[model samples]
Target: MRYTSAIGVTTAITAGLTACGGPASNGDGAQESGGGASGTIEAGLSYPLSTGFDPMITSGATPYAANMHIFEGLVDLDPATLVARPALATGMPKKINATTYRATLREGATFHDGSAVTADDVVFSFERVLDAKNASLMAQFVPFLDTVKAVDTSTVEFRLKYAFALFPSRISVVRIVPKKIVGADAKAFDAKPVGSGPYRFVSAVREDKIVMEKYEKYNGPHPAKAQKMVWHLMSDPSARVSALQSGRVQAIEDVPYIDMKGFTGKNKVESVQSFGLLFLMFNCKDKRFADKRVRQALHYALDTEKLIKTALLGNAEPATGYVPATHPDYSKAATVYTHDVAKAKKLLADAGVKDLSFTLMLTDTGWVKDIAPLIKESWAAAGIDAKLDIAQSPAQYAKVDKGTFDVLAAPGDPSVFGNDADLLLRWFYYGFWPEKRYGWTGSSAYKKTRSLLDRAASAADENKRKELWSQVTDLVAEEAALYPVLHRKLPTAWTTDTLTGFEPLPTTGLSFVDVGRA
Candidate 1:
């Protein structure tokens, strides 16, 4: 696909997975532009458009980033700090009773369409998300919420099914949208989103690019600094680098680990440790993996240090616990697996496994592909025969979700939704993956893990909650149904001289909230 620049010159963008090199071009075209400083900001992302802009169900990288600009929740998370602060609400929601809370809307707030943002809009937003038929990915996060209703024109109240201590942080999962527009045509609304945010949706070309112009009437704490923003969906890593080098784009994300040192001077690069993890998941229904000993054995066999150093080029840190050490609430799990082939072999033998064999399914993520061979080699050393089946995330998960695979090695960053322990842990264990996908929900261990997680979620005492969370972490680590191997750092590159206030995020996607072109 090609992009037509402001002057009607078409710049060809290469559209396949290929080696990273200089930016693609058909001849001399527009180059070296910064969005925040002088003109429209042109940015590049490594992934293409996968989902829509609806905050309740959207999970794609490109769409999620667009939602960051096009929508605002009651309590919004700072893209950099991951801290929850007031956005649409006047301040943090006040706890009225054990199971009820109230928040007042900011005065003079209006949607991009110039319609007033009322308590009804907020109620509709949460109702749609909480509705089970909608299958909202966010519904799982707010299990405690029973109903949201308008108290008056500006005030809104929430009644929880049970007391939830992390209600403030959990409420950040869904962004408020206009009821009239969305209720008219949900599909059309997804394509053309309307929100009270820094930027308003202009157009989207699917896997090519998405455009957003500044919402002139935005009255939020963070207003649009740039007049316009163009997000180029370049799945090819080389294209992203080339766009950065040619100045076609001022900033780019998911910088290739091998090219980190090549950036210099005006082009600055930074890699922040993120909760994004490469995890190993087992199909617990399979007899070979039913025994906890066998699962622990496989984890012990892998030389994770060697794998990270060689395949990841030392860009990742081993998962010391379920959550990365960078997480504020990090806990050290009881059973920490290090490279010990003898221990792995012993565990396998003790489980009455003479010759272990399994098919290892993995996603086609570039980094995972590089690490796949090392995984097979490590398992082979422990006398386990492993076969690899590599495919995209959706395809791989489809097979895993169907109970067709023996093991899965994939990279997932649920931190994009919310960075708290309860949300992060529940993502894999509480609702879907453990029970329906991994077949572990029927087990006693899975039940215990769920109990501990729920106990942690509702605990009023912070210390007691931490202790329960730690217990859950230790049980999951010992069971080894689905656990992280390493928490990788996210590397983002930008022209320091041009783009100001642009900070790299620990989660997925880039933030241009306070950014301005220098």
Candidate 2:
């Protein structure tokens, strides 16, 4: 497959992957000449276009990253820092009462289609996510939201069921979308998104590349610095490194740990401590795992420290709590899963379990694949027989959603959406994950977790909210029904000579909002 632009630049898209490495061109025949703010910024992305561009339901890491450039919430988070700031809105929403808040859109803000962004667009955005039938992935994040109404063409009002102290930062979960485009054909809008953002969506091919151009009409705070961006979807870590080293692209994300030292002086490589994690989940409905002791046993059996050293090349930290230590709200869990083979065996024996054997389903992510063998070995040493089932994320999740899986070890980082403790914990524990995927909703532990999260969400006092969150973290940690195994570092590589204002993100994907080619 090939894409030829109006400017006569032809991009060859190979089957299952795109070709990497060539001189960086400004989508024209000539190479980028000067360190001006107006050239093409090519990047090597570590994930393919697995999901759509719609902010409401898009869950894939790649698309979520793209949306950071292509859309704006009333408030948006700084990609480099997780700090929330006004984007589409003139400023942060102003509180009117205990449960009411209001915001005025930025004057003259226009969508990618050149339509003036109105309060109605903001209302539509929240309504769709709030509507249960849409099944928006963001619905779980804003459970406190009751209604969103347009006060006028510029002003919008929000009524929350309860006073959520984190409401200002939390609302960043829902990105504002053009109502006319989405309401006309949601499926079409999902594929080709249009938003009032700095960068306009140009084109995307599933396994090839995603292209975006600077939205000239954008009146946002962070306007696009580059004229265009070409994100080559290179899932292979080696390919990503090669693209950066060869100067085919200015930056590359998910740099392999083994190749970090090689890029030392030639390119800047930094590994940021991210909330991203590899988690172990159990089918609590299964009689064998219905016992909390069995779940605890499985968690205790793993040699996490050794796994980090061997599989991750010491790039990850063993899970001490639900969130990583870097998180502001992080608290040490009551029961941290340290390696204890004897304790594991005792717990299994206490449950009267003998010859425990099950299929351990895990994703085929680069790092997770490296850790799989060690997982099986650790379980085997604890007198447990385990079968390894490694597959792509979609396939593995298909079985998990259908309740056909025994156990799963997969990478999850809801911090891509928002980094709040309530938001992160509720992502897996409160909603679809516990109720549908892991089958923990029926348990007493699940009920208690729900209660705790609800109370914490409504707590107006910051200290009280943190106290409540700590209790919930301790509860989830001890249960081990579905909990993190380790929080890994996210490594990114970029060249200073070719790009300016590039910062490695502490989250999953790379960001280029204010970045420009040098």
Candidate 3:
């Protein structure tokens, strides 16, 4: 109340191994049992360990999911609802003034290493993120924060540069970490994280699995329900389905759309419409895409509805705005890219463009691969020649960050961090994506977006904030530089009889904070 708040590989062999309850190989190529000690929640995760477990810098889906269990922010979002709630703190930070906040640590809260969680730890956690040298992924989310000071051992004070209406919930972006541990060896802390959460980091094998045990010292609202958790990094879709069907794992995330019906009655399979989306981003500096009309034409060219039906099996909604229609700050954009091949061609012709041809780079995620051909077909229908270059996420992003790619189709869900419209919008438009990734910082439109977002962030009136956000929504939509093609449904599968209190999340990844083995 206070919170008020992939791979496939040798399909037959992997499936057969999991089905036989045999040991699975981790990223280290070491054999480990899919089944762990009693009271362990075994899950098959679709992603491999792409990043480290440090909450401040972790961007990979799998590691981010792991951090949800291994760490805690003073105010954490409810795993299922995305509503802000007190975790390490006693309650929501008390608003001291228009630009200041104060929060008290929960009594007796201790880090997994048995160190008491102090205000200094909280201050350190924030300063590191605020410091540009750390290059934390979270710094962009808290641009209004001016400083964080330890008011006392148990109390932390936050001073913001301006009044931010969402400060209470937005601070959930930074997870509290022990100063002694992280300050001693930052690199070691990244590899093996320590936090004051329900779970303690036991071990992690890059590609194979991540093991965590319930922290006996944890005394929080959501204490661990299971003694241990073993997350199998099974990038292959078949391995995940097989692991779930064979009872080798109690739950699995990213259930392949094609395999949804197969687990109908046998397992509880649910597809929750999520903010997660497949977005199309372009290199604004490219000579061909330098014109905004060229960007708009590409969006109009795509038959999104047909792509959803064919590639996604009708499991996604065409993008009507920057955020999905289900989002709380939903506002219909000024220009929605509905299918119109004629309009696409006309826009291209008006822009004085001819023989538009470029390579469209994309990730090799199962659903993305499925839609690649359809995307190409849709563009081809509009007289555009798009060469497909599909690879794993890291490789594709490597090329993108180097500014060597033309267009990229990638899956992104910032909702996993927080669900507010400002947060979601800023994730792309405000920081790294525009400045570096897509090369849109030089555009006048980008400056306008930044101004509108800053003004909205400081707006005290809720309605006024929404109004500004809506303006941004329209502007970004019309710009069409980096926009969503469709918001896809996240499918998850689990056995109700084997695990109690398990529910599919509307965002990416799976949560088991209060879940237990039956």
Cα RMSD for candidates in order = 6.6, 5.6, 6.5
- For residue 136, model 3's alpha carbon misses the true position, in angstroms, by 0.7
lDDT of 3 at 412: 85
Worst 10 residues of 1 by lDDT: 1-10
Per-residue alpha-carbon lDDT of candidate 2 for residues 305-330, written as tens digits (9 for 90 to 100):
99999988899999999999989999
- Model 2: how far residue 479 lies from native, Å: 0.8
Q: Clashes in candidate 1: how many?
A: 5
**What is the lDDT, from 0 to 100, of the residue 338 in candidate 1?**
94
Top-TM-score structure, candidate number: 2
Candidates 2 and 3, the one with greater TM-score: 2
lDDT against the true structure, per candidate, is: 0.84, 0.85, 0.85
The TM-score values for the models, in the order shown, are 0.93, 0.94, 0.93
Q: Over the stretch 1-518, how does candidate 1's per-residue lDDT look in tens digits?
A: 01111012122223321213322322222233333323467789877766666777777777788889989999999999989999999999999999999999999999988999999999999999988778777888898988899999999999998899999877999899999999998866766678998888877766787777677778889987766778888988888998999888989999988988989999999999999999999989999999999999999999999898999889899887999987887999999999999999999999999989889998887888999999999999989999999987777766775689999998888888788899999988887878777789789998999999988988999999889989988999999999999999999999987777899999888889978656
How many clashing pairs per prediction, in order? Answer: 5, 0, 5
Off by over 4 Å in 2: 1-36
Alpha carbon lDDT of residue 103, candidate 3?
Answer: 98
